[model samples]
Target: MTTTISPSRKTNEAVRPAKQPLRDRLVRLQRRIPIVQLALLVLVCAYGLATLPGFGSWMSIKSILILGALVGMAALGQSIVVLIGGIDLGVAGYIVAGALMVTQFATLNNVPFGVAFLLATAGAAVLGGTVGYLCHRFRIHSIIVTFAMGSVALGLAQLQVAGAYGGGAPVWLTQMTSPVMGTLGLPIPPLVLVWAVVIVLAALFLHRTAAGRRLLATGANPRAAELVHIRTRRVWVLAFAFSAVASVVAGVFLAGFAGNVDVTMGNPYLFESLAAVIIGGTVFGGPGDYSRTVVGVLLLTVLTTVLVGQGLTGADKQILYGLIILAAMAVYGRERRLRDQV
Candidate 1:
């Protein structure tokens, strides 16, 4: 006579062991994702220094910081949208608006830069708020609303300039973004310093403010947030408004960086911003932070610089970006929505 296990016992044993493996796998994956990204950044940097001429040169390094700052600034806004379970496709349009604003209002018309900047940011807030309101009120996905809003913004911007969007930034502004110009003689671009300051402020706003907590709560679970009287719709409105304003700021500085402004000046940043946010391990509906975005920005900049040094064509770069995004998705896509965790 042999002892026999009950069906219930067998089921428990089998199911428990199965779950442990899955749980272990998930834990390992969570640990590996960030480490892998950082490791890749290091590896890419090493490869660049070894194989790419001028990759580690002072000018090249400065170029990387400036380029990364632009992308990081744009991605900063995208991070807010993603945190709130939304995406802002209108970033490019708002960037154009800002660039055009500086060109038309400040440079061409000779309005003061400070006044022009305020007007541009205020207008962006209104447009972005409207986009958020429509999405919330109508229960529409942000992708559709923002895409339409972006097109409208672009058209309006073009119409405003009457197809004559051409101007140079003020000389002082240009110097501010120049690679040779240092912050307080510290050998760092002023634009880079500004980016660093913005990053610090953003991190503080997200982690230290009540409003920031509310935004995170809304993204984690809108219905739950509403049940708790969090006013998620308002959060949405403010989030998108901030997104627009951030894009505008980036655009203005970017105009200075390039010394000129155009309606299409912000086109490339559209996808790059979203790509950086995604690559930064920030999932939709919360569960991410600005620090991750910083790492992602650095990685992307270094990788892109290396690729460019290798003489990759535009088409090839696009293809590579697509593949990199897909890889990031594979790693982070499986995360449970923050709502579930909540």
Candidate 2:
């Protein structure tokens, strides 16, 4: 006897078996951890310990958290933009402008801190959105536009200060930088709480939302994303806007940490932020990776504090950063080429 299987039944069988659970895929992704980033973090921490006593002190620990929170926030912001095949040099502008504006409003104009915060974030969003729009609408390179915009922002920050700049932090702002509580006999800085919230929200936004997946898709292949009806332009705009928001928030934290703001104050963040993103295992053309960026931020902050404790000058920091940037790019570029070849 010959048995006949219907085509529909065969198709159904294939379809049912081909379906894989989302949880399993997520488990696999988690297993494929970025080991190198974590390893580098360990190495950096050890070096910091070897270099300075401040690496272990409560005061140094507090400073690292504040600085890490600020730089990590900025790096993560840049990571968002970077993932979408666009670079945001304007993040520097946002840091300078946002800090200056927030402080200017709170100090010079007597605007409430809450109101100033909103205004500063709004301004950053506008600036970032403008870059996003220009990139999508005019097909301009974000690198060029963002770079120019950043310069413009720096100039505006300088003008806003008008020689009235002094590094005096508000009482409330200072309080925010202090420890909220202690754990295991170690004080935990309040900024850690804020950073944790930002990171958690960021992770959820990028991993658990449709918009987040679309962002990844768009960055992976804009043409393919468009073909799939992904609304790539909207993705670009939103990514940039989000990045701007991160930059501004970072600026606020940094301004609080520094107890003041200046146009040149944000200068170091530009290079360091990009470097942190790179070292965090988020390569060029990669999507936002919140956890790794946080690690990178800590590494950099620790390194910075260590150097400061050793009385290292600005030139020494620059040299160290320059070397790290060069080495990171060399490694990433080579690996990318190898991956492409593979």
CA lDDT of each prediction against the hidden true structure: 0.85, 0.75
The pairs that clash in candidate 1 are none
Supply the global lDDT for candidate 1: 0.85
The TM-scores, one per candidate, come to: 0.90, 0.82
lDDT tens readout by residue for model 2, 1-342: 999999999998887866569966753453356565567668877887787665777776676787788788888778888777788887788887778777765677777778877877876677778889889989999989889877776676657567466645577676676655444455777777678788899889888999888887777677777888999888878788878888877787778777777667777888888888876656655534777677778777777777777789989988987787777667555543212322
Q: Write the per-residue lDDT of candidate 1 for residues 173-225, one digit (tens) a residue.
A: 88888899988869999999998998899889888999888988898899999
Instruction: Look at candidate 2 and tell me the lDDT of residue 218.
Output: 73
Worst 10-residue lDDT window for candidate 1 reads: 26-35
Model 1, 309: alpha-carbon shift in Å? Answer: 0.3
Clashes of 2: 0
Candidate 1 colliding pairs, count: 0
